[model samples]
Target: MGSTPRRSPRRRWASLLGATALAVTAGGALACPAGAAGTNVDFATHCIPPAVAGIPPIDGTTTANVSVDNTSPKVGDTVTVTYTVVTAAAGNPTDLALPADIMTPTGKVTLGGAQTGAVTVAGPKKNTPVPGKGAFPSFSMTGTFTVTSPGAITLSPGDYNIHTSYILELDTPCTVITPPAPVSETVTATSGTPTNTRSISLSSASGNPGDSVTVSGSDFTPGATVTLAGRSGDTQTADTATATVNAQGTFSGALTVNEPTTTGIVAYEGSAWNADLGAGPATYVVNDTTPVPDGSQKLTATVKAGTLSMSQAGDAVALSAVDFGQGGAATGALRTVTVKDFRGGPAGWSLTGKVTDFTGPGAKIGAGKLSWTPVCVTEAGSPSTCAAGSAGIVGVSGATLASTPDGTLTGGEFTVDAGLSLDVPAFTPPGSYSGVLTLTLT
Candidate 1:
């Protein structure tokens, strides 16, 4: 399928009511006091789901309950915010089911009054299966929003987007309408203590090259431009991402890992000590991704494997001897050969065989007299293919026994078997003749 064209972001906040003021941020690691400050905000949200074929846009109210761990936080204190989507306005409205690995809800909450910054919240992915006729799953997102300074912070609902991407790109732009009050919640901050900017984190600790990561910074000067420098060990890499500090002194932006880069990052307000950041930066690990065999989703492993090889079962095969006095034909089963491909690459492999002339007591029989019927079988459930060689004499020129063509994976074990036969002539010299059979795999 071709790439899906992106639709312009829909503007829906203006028409909807106030959203449940939910603030989510990364805060636990920051130093904060044990506190008794809280806010419970409840409100309804109206959303317009993406338009798909044969399914009408779902129109309903999504109720949410939000809470902050500490409302009376001091300057530079980290407070936890939890937003529970009490229920979804609608279920999977499309005829098709949304796949399992789709990401979950992530939205922003706006603040007014004394505090004037926004908090970003995101939930986890890999949710349970939502059947074609099942209801949309309910979810809860929890994170921390850092308190930058002393003020009476008022929370309000902000414009947020949701994704369902199945037949078309899954997108739902939502707005908060008709809340109990204009402000869904409030957080009062006092000028208790001041802690300089010194904390930073990334939404994803690791990712593949060309993948993007979110950089978060707290306690920075409001409206200041924070420079995000990718760090390798103690040295800064060539790549850098930047984010502007909001009115509340918090910032977040995306950084693309163009190469296999180390984790550490330095977010600072340029050279001067405008903020305490860059004093000692924390690192973020972005490792390279490995391609799996047979289109598997095993991306976490970094494996360096060996090449293709072949082994045969049993020592040798002894065909029924021809007595010459009653000569007719000598036949037996060829030894079973196993081929293993571990080259990691998609280039396939081939197995061919040839045999030398039979020799007995200074007399010999032509290798052309030997012919075989070949058979091949791939291992059970293996995403590879093996083909039997043409039934004929395998002489010096050699013939293919089994092969997995190029452009396809030939991983795992595959067996190549053959039924061997030798045409014996009358009065032929046969004193337990033995010949070497050579099999080559590449």
Candidate 2:
């Protein structure tokens, strides 16, 4: 204009203005242009919201707390893990599709869903609704994870993030779960007592040799053995619970007291707990003896040349005699005798005859001859005169005796000497005789 303003090209004028602006903002961006220009080009940036965490609610009592052990999981080990989700911050819901993730990919991570050989993801709904205030959304899920790799995995100990955005389509953010607290429990055994008890006594304290004494005791076991000692007896085994104590306890038989003696018999019982009889042994005493004959003496008679004779003379001719002295003596005696017959037998011989008195020698009077005489003699000798010629005799006359096979007597007689004068003569027979005999006790 003043010199015609030196006219410039249009493209050259545009390039010059862009080069001047690049130089001014080379190291940094340019500040908004003054007032009206900045108002026309407004700019801003937005950030993703933080995820929330919460502990899952437990149904039952927490046993102590969840403790992480050094147990490496195997293929078929039954594993039960419990967890609690706690919300750190409150805003939008956290999608919990995959609650745990395998960082090293050593094993498959599973959640609350049906399982297969491959890795599984499970939990509450992805895009779970979260409240305005910080909320402890509780959840529990169980599944098994299998190790596909051989060695251990090197993983840092920290909260691992679960990518729920890939598994489920959701608008809410996802978060890592924290471990739970630790806990412990106890265990115990018991037993019962036993059941068991013992009975035994003597029936009688005194008994004879052949007497049976009962041993009364209860609960005697089968094949229980009982022994009775002290006396000359033997032991006894009970066939049943009850047994008879014989005189002797010897042998398997009854006890028998054979000999005559006074002894105490001890009964010993044996069982499982008790061995032999101790202080409480059952005892019994036995006593016995042979009986003695009364009012008799043992005697033996000798026959002279197969002949036996006896003479007696008294108020009544009598002889007292006895047999083997087992019973008493025989009491009456024969007066006189005449020979009827005579013989001998196995035991001895006796003579059978009749009794009569002689008035004189060889005197035959009445129906028969009086072959016997009676005599009476006293120490005082007071009666000095006889009936006719001599004094009376106080004893018996001659009597002969013999025996036969049937115990019959024959050819026996009572005889007197022709020259002998007597008042009443009494003759005593020797040895044992059971017939009868006279007695003269002055």
Candidate 3:
């Protein structure tokens, strides 16, 4: 049981207008004609050709129309390319294929149709059969094109004849189809204005430190690069942030102020597509951390002058016990007092010291037995020298002794070194004694 094999479709279909080697053996009978040259083989009842003749006689009208969704498009716009094809014939053609080619001024190819929400076309498309729709087969397809750059874009499109092998069948049940005409179209893109003009605004009219200030812009060039800058008080420019404009041509960002500086009015600026925007001098205030007085102004400050004072350098002065058996003088610890005058003004000040009698629990030692000399040491120059004084009796003249008649306070401060001596009597107290000396400033 052997079956009959058909000839090669490509080789047999190559000769559409003339006879080709496509023989059919049926019941001990050969179907091919006799001669190979100058004889046309009808494929309607013998063979299936791959394509039609290159320049076959036109038997019907075929038209192609092209259009776009947006005639005026800006950069980053997604436009649609619609192609409507019509063939005035009885029904769908036996073999039909349309290969379209498009050339753009800027040959940049955009691959992402899902991202731009447009229909993607990969290659040539075949004709679809629509029964009872019209007298002839009518088909249409739409492709997407994205405007990437700013400028005029030219689109040149044409359809290629790839189905040159398709031809009408002829013989026992012969049928013929008219060839479709070639079509092409060209377009030039133009510029269009944005939906709105470029404008910028601040989140708030005024704000304080630690608060976030939002800067927003709208109606800018779509997908354009933009940057934000600001200046506070007398400070220089500071770049805050950068963002890309969206499909709506809008962008916004927030900037936080954290430091305790630049208190005056603050202004912001921005630019996109060489256009400047966001000119605002917003008022801002940095409050002092210290609590202000009840009657003081919120923006006012006060500075107070210092005062002059005297203080003991160390703990109370300690004097050793002196036995009456020894008639020699008994010396006490060296005592020092400091006079600090922080006031910058030039003035005069007099220093004095008063002492009470040296007394124990029940015994007493007369203050006249103790005398001390005052030595003046000028630690800081007040533009004058401090006069030193001689020793004076404790109770009689030392009780309230003056520094010196000529000792004048100058440049505000000077130190005094006081030396104390106690003259014990023949039968002084048998217990420890203590006294208090008070230093005064005037």
**Number of the predicted model whose TM-score against the real structure is largest:** 1
The parts of candidate 2 lying over 4 Å away from their true place are 1-199, 218-223, 228-256, 269-281, 293-442
Task: Encode model 3's per-residue lDDT on 14-98: one tens digit a residue.
Answer: 0000001111111221111111111111111111222332232333333434444344455444454444433322232333442
Candidate 2 overall lDDT versus native: 0.24
- Cα displacement (angstroms), candidate 2, residue 40, comes to 99
Best by lDDT: 1
| Cα lDDT of model 1 by residue, 233-312, tens digit | 45677767778999987788887766565544567887533334542243344433434457555422233334455665
Model 2 compared with the native: what TM-score?
Answer: 0.16
Query: How does residue 317 of candidate 2 score in lDDT?
Result: 28
Q: How does each model score on lDDT?
A: 0.57, 0.24, 0.38
lDDT by residue (tens digit), candidate 2, 211-256: 6644443333435465433332233222223243333332122344
lDDT of 3: 0.38
Report the lDDT of model 2 for residue 75.
27
Cα displacement (angstroms), candidate 2, residue 115, comes to 77
Task: Locate the minimum summed-lDDT window of 10 residues in model 2.
Answer: 11-20
